[model samples]
Target: MIRLDYPIVIEPAPEEEGGGYRARVPDLPGCISDGETRQEAVSNIQQAIMAWLAEARNLGWSVPSA
Candidate 1:
């Protein structure tokens, strides 16, 4: 199994963007998720991180370090 620890940035979504919390892994470009609450956004981002890493591996892309 691949193991990675990356920094995440969580903030409120813009009012025009539906008002949920948004989470993203800066080291993994385009890896993002959102939820109605901070906790949920965090959980979703964890899944996003896994998916992002898996895809990178599948494509033989170098994974960035935290």
Candidate 2:
């Protein structure tokens, strides 16, 4: 069985620049998502990660070899 582990980091967007939420998966390079609400962003990123993993598996691509 192959198990993948990753860390997700979410932070609030600057209020001055219009409040929102931003999320990033540390283990996946260039994987980032933003949303107008924190919950929306988190949910979106979770799906994004799932899709990304699926694609990686389909293409036989190892995740960053980490």
| C-alpha local distance difference test of each model | 0.92, 0.77
What would the TM-scores of all predictions be? 0.90, 0.70
lDDT per residue for candidate 1 within 26-47, as digits (tens), equals 8999999999999999999999
Candidate 2 lDDT (Cα, whole model)?
0.77
- In terms of TM-score, how similar is model 1 to the real structure? 0.90
Error of 1 at 30 (Å): 0.7
- Candidate 2 runs further than 4 Å off: 1-5, 14-18, 64-66
Worst 10 residues of 2 by lDDT: 1-10
Model 1 CA deviation exceeding 4 Å by range: none
**lDDT score, candidate 1:** 0.92
